[model samples]
Target chain A: MNAKIRALISEFGRLSVDVATLKNEADLYTAGLTSFASVQLMLGIEDAFDIEFPERMLNRRSFASIAAIEQAVSELLAEAGRDAEAA
Target chain B: MQTQEDYLAGLLEHGLLFSTGVDGLFGRSALFEATVDGLNALVTKHGDGFNAESVTYPPSMSRVDFEKSGYLKSFPGLAGSIHSFAGDDRAHRDLLADLEAKRDWSGRQKITDVVLTPAACYPLYPLAASRGQMPKEGLCFSLCSWCFRHEPSRDPARMQAFRQREYVRMGTAEQVVAFRASCIERGEAIVQLLELPYHLDVANDPFFGRAGKMMANNQRDQKLKFEMLIPITSDEHPTACLSFNYHQDHFGLAWGIKTADGEVAHTACVGFGMERITLALFRHHGFELANWPAGVRQALAL
Candidate 1:
């Protein structure tokens, strides 16, 4: 899961720093990821995880960092799993 | 040897755009009007067989609809609510006295039901909703309107009030996404036909605030918005001349725009900033249409 999220960030995040060198909690925007680039990153995460972000979760806190994103995606995946089980 | 300011000054001098000393408001001269009309016509002809329902709307729309559409959630700073003098004669007298004394008199005006339409596509969703369920094949609407934003600029391209021509698609996700892609292709082709060199790139709306930054980032990450940019005020930081946006059920769920199957509809819109395009044409092809390359002139039929 860590490797996949990191890879997605590197591929679509348009970050200035190398993904391998940075800590998970480092501020991506401060390090050079633009708002435009973060959007690209978010789409990549959605595709990789096969999750559609609900409007309630479309805020900045959802994509604030590698850690925050992982939490959001993990929670979403868990919810979807529960939904599928119920279905 | 020419700067953007020089180019803009040339526009004013040539009477292409009349400047009232305001940053984003201008009057179009006969030549400018002809060029805009021709360009709009050319675009319409390009999408000739889409069978899009053409709709023209006044610059203002119902404030209730505007608020319900979640416009304030995304762009509170940019929305302009209409206000008018809703006072009796005695209050009017005070207002006039205040105005004559050059004091604060705006208190007399009350907020009205209308807000300046921020985008050409604003009213379409509600109007479509009123018609009941969207068809299985979905709907496509061609719209033209005077849109307003509070951000004023001297760049001439970034006007506070400008006309936008848009084609909005509503349907299932597959249909709307496909429609958006086709429009991007069309936008690319149109700019080329106009002979304006541009770069197409993933883009985001200028959402406000710290939280808004995240929203923009998410939007960019999703690849939901793409803009065709041309160098106008600055070559290094080119301005967006056209924008293609996929709303992805944001409007559908809010306004209860549902497909025939009762699922939330997906939406996308391709917007052409008319004044900016007109400016870009003048900037790239020189102020006089006669001096523009023969092909460009022929395409616009100028």
Candidate 2:
């Protein structure tokens, strides 16, 4: 999940620094991830993980760091799995 | 002690503003216009030091450029698009009949190629981009325009059609940030000269919808915008009469503007709310300009 998130950040985050060198808790906005780029990253993450970010998850903190992104994706995937089971 | 309604009524009673039957729309009397002009001149006096190129735009801008600016994404509610009658005689007859019958005749109106200028600086970005790369020193512009927003309210300061006097800077991030800092100082100085009690605070645009909440939070987190507030209608809820914004390459990326060193340029602007400040002046210094403070009168040259 970390590697895939890093790959997505590399492709869409438009950060000034290398994603591989950064810590999971590194602030993406400080690394030059603009609001516009963050939206693109959100779209890329949704496409790659095959999960949609709910309206509640659409905020700065949710995309503030790699760890946060990973957590959000994990929770969304778990929520999707539970829905499938209920069906 | 006066409420917004009281202040608005005072303005009307004093012949400062004439009623136009619309809440946010009012015709300024000669005295009101003179005060507004004085405030505009004061802005120019402070901004002249920047040596900015002067540019003036019409009240409306190209719809295509407005869309590219992404204004709709954040402020769809505030945008105003121009529309006109484009149908044939038959449709015109129907429209007149609909209007005569008090039915909705607006459906016959077709959207035009222009939208009302959301901000004085909205048209400047693309023009600056068309001129090619920014100089190492960046570019600066002094602008004033009658801008529009759809919001209507009883607060006279929040006019639907209002003038914004602005100074825009574009270049490297350092250059733009420095420019913004200088404008902040200048903004404080101008208000002090006018002898109006004011405060500056971090602020955000009134972005529309649920998604906008996050966007507003992000903007505040990044400290991208600030406003200078002054008591107009009341002390508790002062009006934002001046604004400082740092766009952080948003305009550069959207307009394909670049710096001399081959990096995307950053942009910043400081806007003076002309009508709001004028209202503040009248509210604080009394309706009669002759009784205003000597220093304030000196600063405004009124």
Candidate 3:
């Protein structure tokens, strides 16, 4: 999941620096992930993960760092799995 | 203690502004026009040392260019598109009949190629880009235009159609950032010269929707925008009479504007709301231009 997120970010984040050198907790915005690029990253993440980010999570903090993105995606994926089993 | 309505009514009573039946639309009296003119001249005098290329645009802009600006994506609620009656004789008759019956005649109208100019500097980017790469010294532009936003309010300061005087700079990030910094100082000086109490603070555009919240937050975190606020309508919610923005290559990337150093040129702009500043002067000094303070009168040369 971490590798996938980093790959997606590298492809769509348009960061100023290389994503491989940055830690999971490193700030993506500081790496030059612009507002427009963040939107693109969100879309890319949604497609890659096959999960929708709730409107409530659509904020700066949700995408502030790679670690933050990983956590949010994990929680969302677990929520989706639980909902599917309930159905 | 006067209420907001009372202040607006006082302006109408004093013949400074005339009601046009619409909330935000009003006819400016000669006194109001003179004050706005004087304020514009004052802005020009302050910017006289920049050697900026001066340009004036009408109230409308090319719809194609406006679309390219992506303004709708961020401020869909505030954009205004021009529409015209593009119809044949039969359609015209139908439209007149609809109007006579007070029905929906807008169905016959068609959208035109022009959209209302939202900001004075919006049209400058593409124009600059078309002129080829920026010089090493960069480019600075002085512009004044009747800008439009769809916000209709009775605040008198938030007019739907208003004039803006702006200075825009384009070049490297360092050049653009320095220009914005200089603008902040100049903005402060202008407000001080007018003798109006003001506070300069970091600000953001009213971007739309949930995603826009992130955008606004990101803008503030980056310290890309600032405004000079004055107590025009009220003390609690002071009006933003002056704005300073650093685009940081946003326009350059979108418009293909390149610098002499072979990188995307960054951009910055400082804008003055002509009507809002004039209204602030009236509110602070007095409704009567003749009775204004000596320094204020001298600065405006009234």
Candidate 4:
């Protein structure tokens, strides 16, 4: 979990130096992650998790912070697991 | 060197401009018709195994669809939305008064579910996605769509509303790349046949925000987008006649378009600004179709 968080932070940090300065839960918009960058970050997250992100989850709120992305990822993974079990 | 003004003046004397303006809302005419014919002729001559299949799309698209495709996030400034009212007479009166006052009436307005499609490819994605999996070979579609842009300019190259002829293909990475490459080669051949001086150059889409900028840069470096530019008015600066775009797995993922193997498909598109190309032809050739080259005329079947 710590390693996951660090990986997330490192990706966010590449987007902005301010992300590294933040203690926790920094607003991504305030951290200088522009909309285009957010999409790139989402692509990165998708690659990292080896998961296809649904269209519904693509929005400013979902990408607002490292914590938010982690939470979304966890939810997606849980949903995927449920789907697998049902299958 | 002959100036654009000088050529336009000659065309005006030939009654080409007036005829174009009178016959069409968007300055279309007999000359324009002839130019389109010429283009078709050029396409047949140069396009490898050209099979012309035409499609006309609705002027508007579902706003929800665009939202799903992330268009709203990228091009909010360029997008135009439809609005309507569902209120009493007093509310209607208030809205009317706001309209009369030329104030911000958007607050009183409720946005409709649809928006005017800014380009032809916007609608094709949904159709392609619905198919689930594309064949290993490819799916090819031709569309002539009415497109709208919010920012209107007086330049003939830049119109508030225009027609676009686009060819879109979806398939495996190799197929998509091959499709774009073929389009580039054919586009250059067509330019040569038209006897127009042109150049093929790397181009970028105006992606929104900083992330979009980075993506644009990546696209540029990868040569994912290319434009065939020809001078219309001035010899110094040129207008883009055709554009070839390679969207590697982007639209495929967004729209759930997959290959036969269940992997995301690669997509590419060739867009021809019918009017801009017509304008270029007119600027290069002359107003009289009879005076044009016999080879060009025969190719157009004119």
TM-score per model over all chains: 0.79, 0.89, 0.90, 0.72
Q: Rank the candidates by lDDT, best first.
A: 2, 3, 1, 4
- Where model 1 places Cα greater than 4 Å from the true spot, the runs are A1-87
lDDT of 1 by residue, A1-87 (tens): 777888988898777789898787877766666544566677778787788777667766677778888778878888877442221
* Candidate 4 off by > 4 Å: A1-6, A9-87, B1-25, B37-54, B101-106
Ranking by DockQ: 3, 2, 1, 4
Q: What does the lDDT come to for candidate 1?
A: 0.84
Model 4, position B231: C-alpha lDDT score = 87
Name every residue pair that clashes in candidate 3: none
Could you give candidate 2's per-residue lDDT for residues A1-87 as a string of tens digits?
888899999999988999988999999998989897887788889888788788778878999999999889888878777432222
Output the better candidate (1/4) by TM-score: 1
lDDT string, candidate 4, B1-302, tens digits: 34655655565676655424422225456867666756754564554453534556797888888787777666777787888887889998998999899988778778889888888888888888887776656688777777877765445566666677788888888987888899898888777766778998898878676556555666676688999998876677677889999987778867888888898788898988877887776677777776877766655666
Model 3 chain B scores worst on lDDT over the 10 consecutive residues at B210-219
Q: Tens-digit lDDT track for model 2 on B1-302?
A: 59989999999999999999998999998888887788888888888779999998899999999999999988998999999999999999999999999999999999999999999999999999999987778999999999999999999989999999999999999999999999999999999999999999999889776557667777888899999999898788889999999999899999999999988899999999998999999999999989999999888778
Q: What share of the true interface contacts does candidate 3 keep?
A: 0.36
Best by lDDT: 2
Cα lDDT tens digits, model 1, B1-302, are 35767877888899888888888888899888888899899889877756799998899899999999877867889989999998799998999999999999888899999999999999888998888897789999999899999987777778899989999999999998998889988888889899998999999898876446667767887798999999877888788989999998778877899898998889999999988898888888888777899988888888
List of chain B TM-scores, one per candidate: 0.97, 0.98, 0.98, 0.85
How big is the positional error of residue B257 in model 1, measured in Å on the Cα after superposition? Answer: 0.5
